[model samples]
Target: MGEKSEANSVAPSARGSLHEHHHHHITPLKEKKFRWRVTDEHSPPEIYNWTLYLSVFVFGILGSARGYDEGNISGTVAQTSFIKEFGLKSASLTATQQANLKSNITSMVQLGSIGGCILAMYTVDRFGRIRTLQGVCVLWIIAAIIQCTSHSVGQLYAGRLIEGFAIGQTTTIGPTYLSEVAPKAIRGLCGCIFAGAVYFGIMLAYFANYGTALHVVGRNQWVIPTTIKCVLAFLILVGSTIVCVESPRWYMKIGNPEMAAKNLSKIRNLPVDHPYILSEIADINEQVNLEKHETEGTTIISMIKEIVMTKSIRYPFFAIAFMAQVLGQWSGANAITIYSPQLMSLVGITGVKSLEMTAVLGVVKFVSAYLAAFFLIDFLGRRRSLYIGISIQLITILYFAIFLTVVPQAAEKGAVLTHSQDMAGKAALAALFLSGTGWTMGFNSIQYLLGSELFPLRIRSFAQSLVMVIHFANQYGNSKALPKMLLAMNNFGAFYFFVGVMAISLCWVYFFIPEVSGRSLESIEEIFSLPWYVIGRRGAELCPDHSEVNRVSYNVEGTGNAHGGDIDYETKPTAEFVENASNEGLMKSDSQSLEK
Candidate 1:
């Protein structure tokens, strides 16, 4: 605890430029320069160079495996050829039966993903981050082969389940590797890249299917997209071997500090003895040491017991895991992402137009998620971003829900709709587009961000695995529920249920999430240590002052904020950094902390 405290505290610095020009060269201090606002801000530009990026991309690209399905599955199953090849169009099958079959095909991957996530819980640590992803990549290729060559429905389900297993492992490993390998300050940037790849895969798949639907005919329509999955998996598998490096922290975790330093120096383009390398290793060791001390023997049951037994860890874990299902999955975003083509069909838009709109939805989801991490979350702060995003979702989805409830199409379709009905239907499509934007900015970003932000080191693996499992389970449940719900009530029932939950989610967000933007890895423990009721509104204010003081917390005044929030710290430094600093007390008004 003493060491963790020292890691987050920064002394005022009035002398120096943040390091620039790299490799064993600690260039002589410049003639004159302004002080560093915070410690991690002292990072060298060398850390941002080519080697770091290549390594991040090698693992980050794995997100595409999960995302490709989100975009392509709807379009793939919608194809004329796929429909006939699987007897989906047969007069013998009822509409409900056809919907059931399509739901199974779309959701089998999600079901498989749940199992894979469970497996990843074991592999991620045992096999290590890089090797786990390598194994999953190979598994994905096998899954893709089955997916592309399937002649029977049973075969397709088998392939998708296998594919889901691999994708689950990839997502689990990708972010873990990105966080561990990238320089601490730029870890946020790498996370955005991972997310962008997911959406990019979705967007590319959407457009590809839209193109194939128009340009190609016959069984080749679905075959091309399935084959594309294999190509993507192959690329990731090859990139890992050629480009990625083992995480330095992983070496430390396994009790090889010397090897950890070796890898850290290579990653940072610094000598093993460089001050930066030593400090980073110390921080990793502190956390790793803490993790081992607390968990002792790491196991799922033990990890769960660790959280349940500790109030500080328990509150945050339960808070986030609940949100993963409520705000993340059941809030209707995944349903919309997975079943969008069908939703478009519901609004009197079918065939080519439905596929095209699905393509557009992909564009909206990809752009908003990618940009929000960099812009929205930083500019708006975590809590407000969720508020504004949910507001957008509330308005758009409510309008769309009302449209469905009041429409003639809600009852039974007439041959031709009145002009007013047609215009209202167009508005409904726009509502979906806007709703998707709202979801990405609000729920999607926050959910992923909190998974990384809120937990202590010891409980991180179990908490993440649990969160991910719920996420996929919700996705699978929603996929099955939508078709059944629409069959039971009107289509609007699901959205009404979603809107009601979202409205509740808004209140929940206000009373739960704190301003997590600029808090360091160590200080997060202080914030979550508070009682649950106050953690949301006052946690940041009440916790130890570790934020980079230069950042503005909100727009309350035009002048610079007294408490600025920088990006969250990727690692916590050791006592050596704090003791060595010139304590002008920058953290006090010289930078004084706000202590409760």
Candidate 2:
């Protein structure tokens, strides 16, 4: 404890010395060029190598596990074979009973996810991200086998419930791993791969379900999709075991500085003692040291007090992540995703055609997610990207609300549509696709991206675990009640509710959430020192933009080779850049969005 506390005090001078040495050694190499460079050249080009990209990509694939579960269940429940095999096709069942049965089947997974999330709170910190996910893969495999061979409704429910454990854990662990491993330069791009995979996973499940329904028969129909889910889980397990390295930040938190340096070096593809590796480890230690001084003890109650009462330390990080989940879940994206078939049918596209349309909607969502990750989140900045996505959602949802009001098709029972109404229904169908795009680009990415990035490393696992608990809770509640909410609120009222929530989300975001696209994780801690109410509006202005810092570019070797007279550059470590940012105009991070 004393050592970590003392470590922070030495970083500035140590970094300053290292910066001057590197500047004198390599600054003259202006005419030299490397094979590749991080687009902004904020980081050593080595950090952007194939090893880092592939590692993050493989870890990112875990998002598909959650996506598959969400997508598969929606279509799986609609399977004729599944319905008949599970006795859900009974003619004697009343409408309410049928709704209750389907809700039970769908929501049991969420109930189990709540348990898995609680477990992740401990295991992610205890076992590390890679191992926790490996354990998750094993649990999911067990669940998948149980689901595949189930002969009765009770067994099916049990299998689904058990599978939720893996889903719950994956949701917490996936983004955390991505954020830790990603270089700050492409953190938004890399972190977003996890979000993008959700869309891909959904698309895969929808396509799988569609293919099975059209081509397969008997118990095999549901079993085949279940098998696909199992295979994906297995693939993730193999990737974790064979490809990815342990999160170096997790190692630093656990007091394994040697291992932390080694792993960070591995991920960055630099030498174990590279200056960047040493500096990063120091930066991470500074964050840990800072967090330690803020709290009184390691007890649960003490932790709670720090998060809730401190108001300046953990509170903003905690609250930002927490509210992002709450607002995101209520934005009605998941509900729309799970009920795409029913909603599509409401617009007069029925039978297997509804399933087909839902799958296409999944494609729209997947494409939008990629667009946000690859281009918007880092380029437009987090706040601006969200605004763009919300604008799209607002327009689409309002169109839906107005169309439902005018048509009154879903609000009434056995109402035959007039010619104009039928044409308008088609347009509503198109609007639903548009809504999928907006939701993916905005709420879905925010929930995963911000939830992972907002917290300090010390509380990240617990924070994310708590967030996922809320996440699955919302998912469970919506999955169970939305079937009923659709009936009780009337279809249009439900969308109207989402419309109100979205408007509030926009305003709340503007007033309470800061633009955080280009800030370092360690630097983020300083932002909360401001009054909470203004943090969102003022936070972006507080941190430095490292990528914009004028630095001599390094060559294929970690630092540039000795050359002619030094090119114009400053000698300061990224950490010192953070302090400079507070007093000067700016200091550090790896994106241009901060320049805005």
Candidate 3:
């Protein structure tokens, strides 16, 4: 009877405390509805607004610009007219000169990208995400104009370098911006749209190149396709300037909490103090405070030390960030993306047929990327999707190597294939297509998504800049080395090398990468704070309870103790308290009551 009375007393007080908490923010009439909505985990998707779609669309267009730039060289280099006009096809030039030309044209952009990314790291924080995007868009337009009117190889190189710089900056900023603005429920889907845009851009380039090769004459063939990139860049500039909202998280981080609440409300299509908006704002503010504490006097040296010396910060996340770039680059996908026409020719696909085949490959990649964005990423989860995709890539690359090795005509320079050799070449082409699918499904989308999620807010931009630097360095090396390597080692040796890299990547994903699906960005930090063993096991598990985090926030803010005079309605019994209650034979009833 005493226990029952105690329970009744506690219940009323708890209810009253919770009521007071709501009354602080909400009118009584709306409190009941707000409580129900905020507590429900599976609320329907937020209403789609033009501002939301426009933000994603602008980012997508920037991705398409990147795709167009990457795919343009593949088909352009293969054109007889392009080579003839540039003195590249002349017997007067040494093989080394020709290879150097190809490498420079492709690699200059990557070098530029590295520079642009470094600049973006500072600019994104200073000028804001929207302005940074707009500045790059203008730079890309000027670079495009230079390329479209180039009178010499030097001019082309200059244009590509500038364009590459712009692409690099956009690549870093676009996905990060999208991730920040998107609602957690559909964040994965929105993040992957950037990947989808990349593939779509690639497809546009391929088809444009194919049409030019078939119908256009002389330099116009290359000129028309190159100009298309400028159009995409222009669209992004306009969209960003006119339609995009500043990231609410950015506003919060910059000491504008009122503006942050306003922007978030606008994005969410809710009142400024709606429970969902309030909860999100609270999560953002708490995370910012935690990061500030973690890196008290933030500096380059201190940030580096924190990442390298802090076990919780380093192990899975820092390591994963580095590996994400390595896997994305060394997975052999970029080699195919930039050199597809050349690779197809090595497999005995020549002339217009090879260009068409490259277009088909682009289509396959586009479809796979879209599928990953819409269906695979959130549904299969990050780790499983990566494993499945890497497995397919490994199989396809091995098959490609085997086919090249067995068919001497495919590997031998200037050798025409026999009937059987032709069939083998076609089979290798099929493997190449499948490899694109696997890569898009696994590495392409996930790398960008993971890069955004892996770090705390305080150092996320710098950490991502570091990742992009390595990413472009790898791309630059591959673009510079791939053409020469293909000729020197035969296509078979190159595939074998990629196979070895992919094998290493597979092992890294299995042991190191954790599942992060369905967890809020703030919750991810808590997951990493667990003992390494438990983190490895349940890092991806949904954390339905927020009381622990609430307690941490209160304590960090120097608020009163959990059991003090003013009740925190958000607090719940700790594990120790629950265990003690179990010992006293009150566990079942107390647990049920607490849950209710």
> In terms of TM-score, which candidate is strongest?
2
lDDT of prediction 2? 0.74
Can you give the lDDT of residue 230 in candidate 1?
A: 80
RMSD from true fold, candidate 2: 7.3
Q: Which candidate is the best by lDDT?
A: 2
lDDT of 3 by residue, 1-596 (tens): 23323433444444444444422221122232112212223221232466777887787567776788888888988888888877776798788889888888878889999998888788888888888888998899899999889868899899999998898887778778888887655567778888788889889999999999999998898999999877887888888888888888887677676677678767767555233454466667667655655667677788778778877568644568778787778878988999998888777777888789989999999999988877777767788778888888989999999997888576445787778777777788899999999998888878778777667678777777767877888899988988888879976898899899889988777767777765566666656666665554566663343522132222212232222224332222222111111222121223432454
Any runs in candidate 3 off by more than 4 Å, and if so which?
1-44, 47-50, 293-297, 411-420, 530-537, 542-596
Q: What is candidate 2's TM-score against the reference?
A: 0.86
Q: Give stretches of model 1 more than 4 Å off.
A: 1-42, 182-186, 410-415, 545-596
1 or 2, greater by lDDT = 2
lDDT of 1 by residue, 1-596 (tens): 44434434432121011111111323343321111211244454445556777888887777788889888887888889998999876889998998888899999999999998888888887888878888888898899889888999999999999998988776667766766675544455465567667777888888888999999999889889878888898888888888777887777777776677777777887665334454555456666776777667666777778778888777777775557565667788878877888888778877887899889989998888777766766556778878988989988999988998888463344447789888898898999999988887788766655665567655555566677787788889988888888777778888888898889888888788887664445447678778888999998888854433222121212111112222222122322122221121111112212110
Which model, 1 or 2, shows the larger TM-score? 2
How would you order the candidates by TM-score, starting with the best?
Answer: 2, 1, 3
lDDT of each: 0.71, 0.74, 0.73
Q: Please give, for residues 1-596, the per-residue lDDT of candidate 2 as tens digits.
A: 34433433433444444345445433333432321222544455566667787789888888898888888888888888888987675888986778889889988888999999889988999999988999999999999999998999899899999999988998789889888888765677777899889989999999988888889888888899889877898888898888888998898777676677678878988664344554566567656655656653686666566678666546565567777777788878888888788777667676677778878988988998987887777777778777878778888888888888777764354668888887788888888889888887787777877778877787778877888898899888877877787788767888888888899889977877777775667666667778777788877686553321112244433443111113222333333222211111112222222221
My TM-score estimates for the predictions, one after another, are 0.84, 0.86, 0.83
